[model samples]
Target chain A: MNLIGISINHRTSSLELREALHLNRDEIVSLIPLLKEQIFSEGVVISTCNRTEILGFPQTEGLDVNSIIGSLLQAKPIDGIKPEYFTRFFSCGAVKHLFSVASGIDSMVIGDSQILGQVKEAFEISEDLDFAGSISRRIFDTAIKVGKRAIKETTIGEGAVTVSYASVQVVEKIFANLEKKSALVIGAGESGELAAIHLRDKGVGKITISNRTIERAEKLAEKVHGEIVPFQFLKEHLHNFDIIISATSSNELIIHADEIKTAMKKRKGTPVVLMDIAVPRDIDPDVRKIDNVFYHDMDSLKIIVDQNMQKRKEQIPLVEKIVMEELVGFFNWYNTLDVVPTIKSIRSFFEEIRLDELEKIKNKVSDEDFTKIEDMTRRMVGRLLHNPTVKLRGFAESGANIKEVLTNTLILKELFNLEDFPTNGKSDAEENHNSEGNDEKN
Target chain B: MSQTITTLNVLLPLLYLTSFTVYLYDFFKEQKAVGNVNRIILFITIIVHVSYLLALTVEYDHPPITTKFEIFSIIACSIAFSYFILELLTDIRGTGAFIILFSVVFQVISSIFIGPNYKVPEVLRNRLLGLHVISALLGYSGIIISAVYGVLFWLLYRNLKENKFGLIFNRLPSLEILEKLSYYAAVIGFILLTLAIVIGIIWLPKAFPDFSYFDPKLTGTLFVWLVYGVGITSKWIANLYGKKFIIFSLIGFIVAIASLIVTNSLARTFHSFY
Candidate 1:
């Protein structure tokens, strides 16, 4: 029931290392059996673009990281890399790391919403391969629940976390509905094309792509199902579009204040949003002074992105609280697994003594008196065992130090002379032999 | 029965104040749980308000529209009811703070100035007049809600334009949703106001042969109706929307409020039952 993990994420490894360490679906499937044979009893591997984590339950006291790494290299070998590139976590730290990763708090983009599905896929693959045991399955299930709870209960996923998405959000703030609005992309460059695609996805009715070259604009317009407009006609038809995204490479302003003024008149007081995502600036900054015109550049869009990022960061503590609470619940349940068999042993020991003493007196008593005496002895045995059973369960749930609870359980086993009690259908003699071997190894 | 009414007089305002506080907190905090609590308090407040009105009707043996206090109470209840439906439909709770605040003020005023033994005029006791008053008050409530939405639209519009990204910008609905809601509310208000005017015109001469068409309240009501009518027509026909529509609704609500104040305070019309 000891958990261990190794993580290589964006913070700990370079992109090249992460790419090299990443496990494909086939590689993960092939690696699970080797991981179970060499390193752990059960294991799961979560591989995404930003991170690669291998979590496992070890059969022994100390985990051999090199054996796990050796198994991974056997699946997919790399030329030159050492084990130091991967950060390792044991037990509680490992569980917490997985929880945070599943909750999307540890993602490169906070609350990106893709990591949870990745974790679930990893767990499913492990389960299919018969590499996941009861403990690992419970951990993954609880992690998934925590992830969904974080999303549903908080505003962490409310706003756009990227600049391209933020551009659409800005347009949404001005116009109530994008369904009736039209957009114009001033350049067919990467940023401009991304904005156009986002606008299309947001259900903007019409999109027109404009560039100095009609060929590139035509290509982009075809992809987004937009109309191609000539570069020269940009100012003439600016009034027809409710949103304008400009990301040209021009060092000079492509759109001027006077041009927007003329377009505003033709627009008849309708609002227009102009986004300038270029470096040297595309739309004239002074055009922001016009009435019914909302002009934002890369810096302003970044502010929105930063604000959304900050909001998600603020929710990290709340998500962490939920994760910690779930972890406590899980560990409490796990602790009871250790105490349960012993409690059963002690109860049976008391019942056996009470029954033997009752049998010895059965032939010496009348029928009514025999029944009464039997009932009284049964009640005494039940009362005598109730407090100890309650206390043992309380200890398990109290989240006390696990080592101390284990020591107490061993003491009870010796004191009650119940070392011969079978556990998990294993004779006490075999269990003792296993523990002695583990102690000798330690 | 009297003790029950007295208890409600104290209980209703306190409940409204509690709801107002919760809504205001939710508006600023934007927490989902706080919003749920605010809605629950508002629902309870509406129930208590209805009970108070029903008890008053039972006590008076008539509809509870014969006094100034009763009219204001009904207006507050109507606004709450309308807002509840809108909230249920749209899931927009940010504007509840403003609407509930207005209801609290109206209810507080009604409770403070309530008269126990006010009598309905003989001619005004007809069911038609009661319907007229109720429709008029409901219409006014709708317009007031529309005006609140209009203000929110402008606030969000300005915040987005300035790139301030302040609390209001984060909390309020998009400008388009607010504009549509305001437009819908104005349309409802316009139809109800039209009904009130029609019923008044039909019942005026029968109730008061000496009723003058030149009465200030009558002209004021007509003028308010004309404003909303023109606003809605412009929005529907000319595609005049956004800031212009919001401004139009705000102006109409302001005029309606002015007419109400003038009719109650200065005009000597029979409509001024208060």
Candidate 2:
């Protein structure tokens, strides 16, 4: 089968656009059947926060891959493919892209390394559907191996890549030592908990976790060996802590100037470090003005994150080299698809001839003699064809295009009069997004 | 035979004392070599110091950490050891090195001026005296480390406010780090030092009620406790974090160490120059 891919990713779309294309598991089930009704479908869809893509092994040539894309996207195919956002790659190019992504070599944060498992799940879903093609099978496994190798050979995954890690670094940078200090976490959200864990490792004497939901605060506190502080008690205890990290989803500011001032009075002019990870910002901006309080809000965090993204971008060329080598390897195997069927059919023709010859011998012999004749003929055929068949497979595997000469000469028609095998192994016309003119390029 | 040491026997403490002055200079100036230099000097001094203690050991027929001079040196060693641990925990050893050096100097001074001689007071010749001296000194070492970092905080803070971007910032921790380190050391030292102070109070009258309450030991002991106590409470309730608390700690530790030297002067008559 001929293969092709179409994708639109985070680089091209906003969150609104990504959500528009999101497919639930049940939706995928029903959508596949509907897509099958419109065109042949040996296909898999990958829908994640970053990208949505379709991988199809089409059964027929000259099918419009984009005609089927309309079922998902808005407007005409050409306009819908905003040059900035969408890309199309065929066969080998598609395989390489899949592998790099599965390996997390293509991640915005290189070696963040979550994509391998995500790719595995996608493979499993396709396997359960019994729709996994050879290219899909080999590339995914290789991608996972490459992902692990990147981690092993390079320090790619070793350092702090996440915002959470950087946040901890900032706190530790200021406090010189935090072992005896108490730390207060204002929210029990994921980011807040992560900050707490980082502090806990620093040997902060006491950790206070307070969430709007007391249960969550208690649970998170228990894991980190921290105490559960009541959300209301935060102001009173604010002066008690050396550090405060806020990640609560509060619309209003959680700690205002007035509250901080009171806390400051209790603190005997000792400074408090405040880190606000909340989106709307839990700590009032004015709280920053309080002498001895160091306040950093979400905006500051974003600047750090943006800088990290730039740093990751600098690592891309190295990853791209790996992607290119793997792509070339996949393409060599892909381009040799033509010779496989020729080798298979040549063996089949020889077998047919041996059987036909044995039937003739049977007609000339008695019933008991016919059985002996059948066994002898079959053994002779294997002895004659085994070497040539093995050699032909080897030749095909080594990138020889034997099928091209065979097709041009029409030797099978002249000798055995057999029709050639159909060109592609899959049916991908179901949602063909290709136009007629595009078929000539392949 | 043990070698004879004269008034210049005081030079053993002098070696350590002069080193801290270099460190304090390096603290605000060429800050990079403080830890490395201090470590090398401390090692050499400790080796020589152990010999000094050994000579006194031979005279006393026991570990000579009891006498004020030997006790001070031992306290210096304890400060150095804690500084060693601090170095391991955090690489910000530049700030803590000065305090360790200070401890060494004071301990050496005690050994030279108070109990440099082989003779010890009969009242001071007990196992409890060793326990009291060693424990109190070690705890004082922690207080000393914290106070030094506190001084770093003051330097860093003032420089930041003055917007000097000065030399101290380069060598020392940012005010934040100083605050944290000082607090951590204060808490640990306070716990241990408080214990030593309490035991000494209990044992004092029995051994020598003549050791007056107004004596340098009483004042010095109380002063050390107050300084350490203030550091701990600042962390808990007072907005005492960062540079301010650290500065207070530095100043407090300085007074405390000086008071301790004066207290050691009480053991003057019995000890002779070796």
Candidate 3:
């Protein structure tokens, strides 16, 4: 599978450029239908504040991924937007990049667990659009595991000083007239609690702390006098809150910036100061440049400690370690996955041969003898396949693309008919037949 | 209660300073081993600080926040403790070490004139007075820490702006997080300061009979209060902060500390629980 990643990450780029390039959820929905027009196998959209990446499983006869991006954005010109915004494509590189990004290895702050959820949500949206399939599912799930591993293995962000507090200042910097307003802290952790505490002391009349774990957020809510509210109820109760500081550490950018903008738009542009303290940051930074949608980071809690510059310095080594290890680990595992379908196809063909031969001789054999023959056939196939499976798995685990090696080895030419299986991952003929039969019932 | 008193003018503050030295060493050295050592040493110092407070509490038969000397020392102690918690939570190692060092120095300086509040009659003890005293002192601790962060932010901003230093900036998260943290901390400080000042003003007529008007402590506190007020207003209203705001924060710390010293020297305040 060919993977093309188009992203605008923590690089310096204007919002206008990003907007011209970015695909809103609705736009992505429209584009998903468009992808049915392309030969790409599967697709997912990840629009974070720092970056907007589209990971596509392209056909082997790969065309420009930009057409997908352009078609999504409707061919709008992004002014002076550097090539830096867009990253490289991959035969299987997107999986590794995604694993690292979701794992917090690629995050500004290492050990931030929120990116996993943001990634999952993007996949979810893709799934809703009927685009995300096995690869998306496996890759996104692995991303979560990688994130959990970062937290478990390192103290990259041990103190969990979320930068949600900084988002408040972003608002303060923008409006400079916050005395009349209140802020809602949507989730409590290092970021939400800190934001609420800041707002409370800002003499804000209201400071509400809502969290998936409302009980956990109670102390902060009571301390800040924002009141305790459940996370489930937020959608309905959101109208009452003005500034929503969401730091739930959810995988998705839970509060879509557009949701806030729309909510505020209906209410005389009530400034919804959304500070994301969960890394990959809670706030979609894109929302900040949006009209009246003040946003902030899920950066480190350096703000509360006040010695952040020094602290960030201290965290460098740990972050580097996390990023490096994840990079290596991801490359290995991704390469292994790349070789999987070939292995599966090879195994399928052998099984198909064995089944056909058995069926051909069934009438000539006794039932008991047939069972024995089947077991012997399976053992023989396994013995023959053991070396390649073992070697390929080892290569894939270390971020080596075994499929490339297999291609060079001409294993495809020797053992199988490449056209029948289709390198672009066309559904196996049997699956197509089965699905077609199922469809006939409908 | 008076039985524990020996009138030993003090060598303890010096010892705390020594402890601060250890914490400083731990903070700047960039070693986890050093942090472990510092945590141990700071833990001991915390014990010492708590003991000092407890001993005084027994001698005076109240919380240690009963005298200017005790208040200053306790505030320093509280700051150290709170900072440790923050460090442990954030796992941001060296920053807490420096803060502890600063706390140690502040405590040492304030300890020389560590004015202890004498016993008060039952009539002087009220809920508001207690809240006023504790919150005010806590506010002092928070502000002191905030000022430290302000200094860090200023240093960071300067380094980035002038290219004089980037090590600290590079090591640090984005300047935005530091500035945001400073703002949040100052806000919390303001809440406590406001609470403290409000109660101080309300009780003046009853607490000090001859003082129907405002006193030096009142004025000094008002000045700090104004600084916090401006800080808060500017954040919410204009979202502006820079060297000026940092300077204001530093000034707030200086003024608040000075007035606290002056007030303690002048009278044994019911609110003097450092």
Q: List TM-scores for all candidates, in order.
A: 0.83, 0.49, 0.40
Clashes of 2: 35
Q: Residue A317 CA error for candidate 3 (Å)?
A: 4.9
lDDT of 1: 0.85
Worst-scoring 10-residue span by lDDT in model 1 chain B: B115-124
Docking class of 2: acceptable
- Candidate 3 residue lDDT tens string, B69-136: 56667678778876776666655554564577666666776667765466666544566676787788
Highest TM-score against the true fold, candidate: 1
User: What DockQ score does model 1 reach against the true complex?
Assistant: 0.50
State the weakest 10-residue window (summed lDDT) of model 3 chain A.
Answer: A433-442
Q: List candidate 2 segments past 4 Å from native.
A: A1-4, A10-27, A30-43, A56-79, A82-85, A90-95, A103-121, A133-138, A141-286, A297-299, A310-442, B1-133, B144-184, B191-222, B229-248, B256-274
DockQ of each: 0.50, 0.23, 0.03
- Candidate 1 residue pairs that clash: A176-B176
- lDDT tens per residue, model 1, A1-442: 4688888798887889889878889988888888888788888999998998899987777668777777777887887767887788888889988999999989999887999999999999999999987678778988999899889887767788877789898888777778899999999988888888999899999999999999999999999999988998788898899999998999998999999999998988788999988899988989888878899998989988999999999999989988898888878766766776787688778878988998999899999999999889877877787777777766876868878778878888999998765566763323333433231222
Model 3 regions lying over 4 Å from their true place:
A19-23, A60-62, A75-100, A103-114, A155-194, A197-306, A313-317, A337-392, A395-442, B1-274
Please write out the lDDT profile of model 2 over residues B62-175, one tens digit for every residue: 666644455666776677668767776886556644665676566657754664345545666677866876677677777877777676676666554332433453456666
- Which window of ten consecutive residues has the lowest lDDT sum in model 3 chain B? B1-10
The true-versus-predicted C-alpha distance at residue A273 of model 1, in Å, is 2.8
